[model samples]
Target: MRLIFTLLLATSLSVTGNARIFYLAPGGSDNNAGTIASPWYSLNRAWSVVSAGDTIYLRGGTYAYTQQTFGYMVGKNGTSANRITIKNYPGETPVLSKGTGYTNNNEHWRGGCYLDGDYITIKGLHFAGYTQADNFVWSGLFINSSNNVIVELCQFYNNGGGLILEGASTNNLFLNCDAYNNRDPNTGYGNADGISMKFISAGSTNTVRGCRAWENSDDGFDFFDNNGYVLVENCWAWRNGFIPYTTSQGGNGEGFKLGSTNSFPSTVLRKLTNCIAFKNRQSGIHQQESQCLTQLYNNTVWDNGWDGVNFHYLNLPHTFINNLSFDNDIAQVQVSGNSTNTTNSAGTGTNDGGWTVNVTAADFITLDTTGISGARGADGSLPVINFLRLASGSDLVDAGTNVGIGFNGTAPDKGAFEAGGAAPPPANQPPVANAGTDRTITLPTNTVTLNGSGSD
Candidate 1:
């Protein structure tokens, strides 16, 4: 009995200790040595060898290619816990690309890490572009699968495209990523969107948090032909252009652009919170021909070339809450065409001749005493507005409706940030370490292990 029990326990331990690690160097080997000293030469080689629960570490160094065309076509799939992770080794950014001197006009030569598998985690790498014109053809990371994937703390610059999450990718997240400086030679336009969710059929919930999109030739974040729930919170976009325009279409260049062509069970529940948009040539947030419940709260829209918020063909049941607008050339909120009554509250508009509170139907605007003072109604009660901006020394200093959403335990100041109280500092920055020299593509004799020991 003792001998049999010992053998069974050993077998269980073997199964539990099956975590493997692969390393990728600037110039390395793909042999199954499983040592940082002996690493894989290419990303595809690592992908081929890693199992469902394996992690491939890319060591610090610019893994540049002499050839103009170098791309990684992934072939492996992973589960939720055993998902394959391609992350920085420990100390530096793993630069992944073909070569530097290549011109952008090579249409056939496409490159960048292409992902088709599910449950993948890519972190802490810099994806650089080949040529200015090539920015339209290549992408930093292309994701097609779904379920518990994370793309965090990556830098994508001058690429043909940023991150593309398509093909029913649900429960995926893009956190703390940056995309800028992508240019296209064909249209004299660039494809430098921070993130784009296109052609999604299923109802996926994708959240973009603490990301920055700037100076992209197109809109900062574009949701094209998608029918999914998207939440963009605490992100920044500046100096981008929309379609049909060239130079910095300005004013954060249409912070959020939504268009649903087919309208079959149209995209629903788009929310923007705690964001700031300023100094773009166009409106801060623009929606066109989409019947979705859009909500904008605790955001600051200022100094845009046009209106602060512009909408056309936007259906009813939209909520604009607690936003501050100032110094825009047009109205704070501009709505034309036939549309249902959207709620507006707790917003302050100033410095423009346009109405501080402008609406197609005046009866729909309601100011609530729960927020700071602004527009008064004939009944001597405050109309309930969607967004409320607190004036200096105003009673709204601590007066706000506790909606119990997105509150960070501060006193719930009247506006986005905790007034008089410090705004909660941005989330802790990701650990700074080199990502290039960390991953070595080597097959391990031992199986990969999955653990849930860390703090949740």
Candidate 2:
């Protein structure tokens, strides 16, 4: 009887042919009907009926009332112009999971929905309540043996192993998805990593952008055991425990953790830009392993429990330019263990722990031309740092070395701010409060200029 039903569904789908649209609702029909009123009940029914260039739209509701398994293989050489699209209707949230109150020993009872295809797009769906410690029971959306796919604008909350992209899945993009509050009922160790892209094979060129991961028990985002080019931009991670655990041996909970040693001979290059890390329990940002280039620019790291930028391991070269670190208890840049070949400089800072250089009038125009703005000391006033300024009676009007790093523009400036600084003024103009007066402390070599920015 089941075989006959499958054949009938396949035959109906083949008959309808190109560009068909089907709907899935609770306990609906599966006789190849495409209307929401007379929709198909299960994804399997829709899959059996959907052909190339077809779309399967799921209604906004809970599905799989019973413990049922639905495995759909996407990709199948679907073209970018005529690809298969599985999406939820606009302004609706659909959930796919194993039936409620059904717990299995292998953890496979939590909505084992697997995708094993390529060139497919799944968007705007919410997957939850799934639990899987090992690889058996997976998350709401498990993608294996797929490529050239995109999952965007979806929410994965309160599920086990939130979202897993494994099994040689390459060239996939996860955009603006949320994974949080997922817990493992069995071992009590689960991760709400907005997403975990595990490539057993070589998976390259993946992008994760505009995502928010907060308050998750595990790292907000983690990538391991793969040789891929990943770019994480404009993402925010706060209050997440053990954030970005790259590896067990040399992994520190950080706002952005990149590169790992889980798989030897697997080189990965990650680029992180325009991000902020503050008040995290661990380091604001961590980079380990060998030959991993962490280019951090135009970022703000302040008030972290540990060092603002922590680099460990060996041969991990970091290019840090034009970043601000203020009031961190530890050194702004902490290089420990056997790590080598690191370059650190001040692009900007209010209360930083480093060599204090004065910027003077002569050096100001020169340094400003080079893009290094004069230092606004603790007193909210500009100091001087130029070579000739020091030769004259000027305190720091000219007492800086011309051998420092240059800015993005022509010439070089002294202190944190270049000619055109990265930190912008706060929106919505408001009145400034004065803290009274400024006190200057004279040091042996260079005088310490105290500003309203407080202690570092």
Candidate 3:
């Protein structure tokens, strides 16, 4: 009977073709057919029929994971040509929430969607409002052993962890995602961060591009015991450790905690380029105990409670080029060892200026967020705001030297925002009909989900 059923399934697929899309809706029933008019209520029901080269479309509505269990697609593998995609339906936002009583005791239960599949893509969905279950570090999206995965344009709000990439997950890309207000009361063992990639071996290479992480309880971006190469670029981390929404306190609240809770080499070789770390409670851009080829280029650290750029006890030939800092506690840029650095200036020369001409916040147009931190440009890059722009007559306008990256006037602008660089062209949008690398499905497999939006 099982063989007959398998043959029937293959024959049905042959009649349709390869590839499909499944739809889910809040008002739908689990027994309903996974179709547009008759959508499946549970992601598990959609998973029962979905295969490689499939898309899962979740319609616009609130999915209460507590009332109805959270959705997850795990332990499935998709071939390169037929990657599984789970995303928001076109032109609508699918909100996933875990209200109170997800657990009676208030322990973290790894809420939201847990993904353990490889060659998958998750995009354009939002997760929020889950009570910690068993205090076991939960996340809106958890990816474990998932290689070649792409998670972009999703969001996390008020969850324990926004995104957790863990356990031998390799060659994944997370782009254009935002996280805020995620916290766990676990105190010293803080279980909250905008994003975390932990316990990953060197073989796991990941990249986060054009993302924003703020107001998280713990660090904005954290890597705990990741001996891997994770490149983070054009990202923002700010206003952490203090809840701007409420008068509550936050966790460590560092902007980018490159490596923590272990030795240095594990965190070395990770590259942070063209990133911004500001207004965090701790050091803006910090790394400790490293002796390897760690790279920091074209980054901006400002208004952090501690050192704007802190590289401590490192005997490595690290590179810091064209980075700027100001308004830090001890000093602007604090490094324990001499590094191969240049064009890095900070407050009191203890910053990136490194005994050169020291500049203050007076060099900027406005030290406040008058125009910056608004909407991004068409290309999804940082918006062109004068909030931190160098004045025409300011010394920082062209003080930076060429380091083989794009610049406006003479050199790169001193900080994350370039002085007058044009916004990059808009990237490819999703719900593609047909093309190479574009997601598509036939009439028989019309159920579909949105794919990720690409960023740099």
lDDT of 3 by residue, 1-456 (tens): 011111112223333466787888878888888889998876767776777888899999887755423466655777777788888998798888865455332221476667777888888888887645556666787778779999878888877778888888889998888888888775432668898887777656899998888888888898777777888988989877775355366677788887743444434567888888888888798774434457788787887887787775545556787787877776787664656777776766464336244667777777777544466554456665566667667777777767666788866766666676565446545332322255444455433454333222
Give the higher-TM-score candidate: 2 or 3. Answer: 3
After TM-score superposition, the amount by which residue 351's alpha carbon in candidate 3 deviates from its true location, in angstroms, is: 4.2
* Alpha-carbon shift of residue 247 in model 2 (angstroms): 23
TM-score of each: 0.72, 0.63, 0.83
Number of the top TM-score candidate: 3
lDDT (Cα, tens digit) per residue for candidate 1, span 7-83: 11233342234768888888786664646888876777776678777788888888775443234545577886577
Model 3's TM-score against the true structure: 0.83
In model 2, which range of ten residues has the least summed lDDT? 1-10
Query: lDDT score, residue 103, model 3?
Result: 34
Which candidate number has the best lDDT? 3
Q: Candidate 1 overall Cα lDDT vs. reference?
A: 0.59
| Alpha-carbon RMSD of each model | 11.2, 20.0, 8.3
